[model samples]
Target: MLHIWGRISSINVKKVVWTAQELGLNFQRTDAGGLFGIVKTPEYVRLNPNSTVPVIEDDDFVLWESNVIVRYLCAKHSAGQMYPTDLRARFDAERWMDWQQTTLNPASRPGFWQLIRTPAEQRNAAVIAESNAAVESLMATLDRHLAQRTYMAGEHFSMADIPLACEVHRWFGLPQPRQSRPNLERWYAGIRARQASKGVLDLALS
Candidate 1:
């Protein structure tokens, strides 16, 4: 069994949990961050120096970082399929996964933090507005990118979609005005409809 340490409310954790479910891996998740408060302990510190949610232990092997964990699991369990065997397709998948963490998540997180996690009285409208604008622009990017392709990597669903879908779930759940992005919406609808998306995608952002 795979042992995961993280709260489901964390987007990073959601990515891991959804990937495990999608791969049909048996996993037990332990709450360990934010309000849960176990991460600072010596044991968790040994597992992840960054003290982040979503550190996974498979038997004796320990891994951290949500995207890396997703990649590891996919490659280890479903090599030629969900992991993408073709070199071009594999790197393409890697690119989109990197985009989710490096580009999209940064742009959207401020607004998500402001609206969902922060108290209204203490919220900074300016930051939220800026984040919303940046994220809307990224949504348009995804829309155009998906105008031709069905999924992030290619025709078949792959590891690339997991992180990006979690990012989309966070952004779309934010209460704000956004331009109609038909292509992006179409892509995300497919993601949300996946059986593996049930718990992660349906949850309210925290």
Candidate 2:
């Protein structure tokens, strides 16, 4: 069985969990980061030096980085559908996986830290406002892409959808002025209907 070290509340961790379920891989999840505090322990740090949630041990092959884990699992178990087989299609699927890490996550991370991690009294109003604006700008980029395709990569549902789907949960759940992108909303609705998504990604923010 695959063993995952992370707290379920983490968006990154949630992405991996949902992907595993979608791929029908049996996995054991252990609480590690945030309130759990196990991520800092010597044993956990050996697996993930960054001390982040979502380090995984698949037998002897250890893996960290949530998006990489999603791709690895999809390639190992569900290629052609989830991971895709053609080089161009796979690259297209992977491009958005990288994009979420490079673009969307950075913009939203500050807002997540400010709103959820920092207590309201200790929060910096100016930073929070700026972070919210950054997230809006980042989302506009996604809206543009989603307008053309049902999924991030192309016509098919693939691993590309996983990372951004987790991010979308946060975007829709968060309170703020948001543009109504019908195509983006339609894409999200399709992912939300999946059984694995209902089990994992639909959980309330912690």
Candidate 3:
């Protein structure tokens, strides 16, 4: 059985959980990080020096980094299906995944931290406003891309959709102005329909 160490509320952790469920792999998830606090312990540190939620142990093989874990699982189990077999298709998926990490996550983090984690009294309105604007700008790019395709990489769902969907869910959960982006909304609706996203993506934002 695969063992996943992380709290369910973590967006990165949710990515792994959703992927494992999508692949129908039997997994045991142990709560760590945040209030759980096991991440600082030596045992957990040995697994991930970064002390982040979501470290996976597949038999004796230990893996950290959420996107890499998703890719490894998909390649190991679903290859030509979820992982994408064609060289171009595989890199397309990789491109979107990288975009999520480098572009979307940074633009959206401030708003999410201010609105969800920080108390309203202590929140910086300027930071929140700036972050929200950045996120919206990036979302516009996604909206345009999605206008032509059903999923991030192509028509069929693949590993590319998972991380980007998770990042979009974070942005959508913030209580900020959301301009109408029909294509982004349409793409999200499709993601919401997937059974594997039920306990992860469908939940209220933490």
Candidate 4:
């Protein structure tokens, strides 16, 4: 059986869990980060030197980095479909995945940390405001990009949707106010409706 290490509350872990469920793989996940605290152990460090919450071990293969795991799983099990076989299409998926990690996630994380993880008295209002503002701008970009397509990579639901959708789930879960971007909301609603997202998206942020 494939083995995964990460607590469900971690967004990165949720991406892997959802991807695994979408692929219909038989797997086991252990709570290993946040309050769970197994990530620093030497055993886990040997699996992911970065000490990240989400790591996967499958039949002697060890992988870390949440987005990469999503790509690897889809490429392995659902090639030419979830993974995208065309050169342009595959890289288009890659581009958005990179943007989610490099741009959107970073912008929204401060809001999530301040609003969800930190106690109200300790939270920084400025940080939350800046984070929300950045996300709103980025979301407008996404909303425009998604206006013509049903999914990130095109009409089909591909691995590209997984991490980005996870990102939207996190951003939207924040208690901060946001104006509805119809296209963005539509895209997120579609992914949330997936059976693969049942436990993942429904989870509350910590």
The worst-scoring run of ten residues by lDDT in candidate 3 lies at 168-177
lDDT of 3 by residue, 1-206 (tens): 99999998899999999999999999999999999999999999999999997999999999999999999999999999999999999999999999898888988888899999999899999999999888889989999999999999989999999999999888888877789899999999999899999999878887
Q: So what's the TM-score on candidate 3?
A: 0.98
Clashing pairs in 4: none
What are the Cα lDDT values of the candidates? 0.93, 0.87, 0.93, 0.92
Candidate 1 lDDT over residue span 129-165, tens digit each: 8998888888888999999899998889999999998
lDDT of 2 by residue, 1-206 (tens): 99988989999999999998888889999988888999888988899999998989999999999999999999999988898999999998888898889888888878777777788899888887887888877777888888988789888888999899999898787655677877788889998998888667677776
Off by over 4 Å in 4: none
Per-residue lDDT value at 13 in model 1:
95
lDDT of 3: 0.93
TM-score of each: 0.98, 0.94, 0.98, 0.98
Q: How many backbone clashes does candidate 4 have?
A: 0
- Deviation in Å, model 4, residue 106 alpha carbon: 0.9
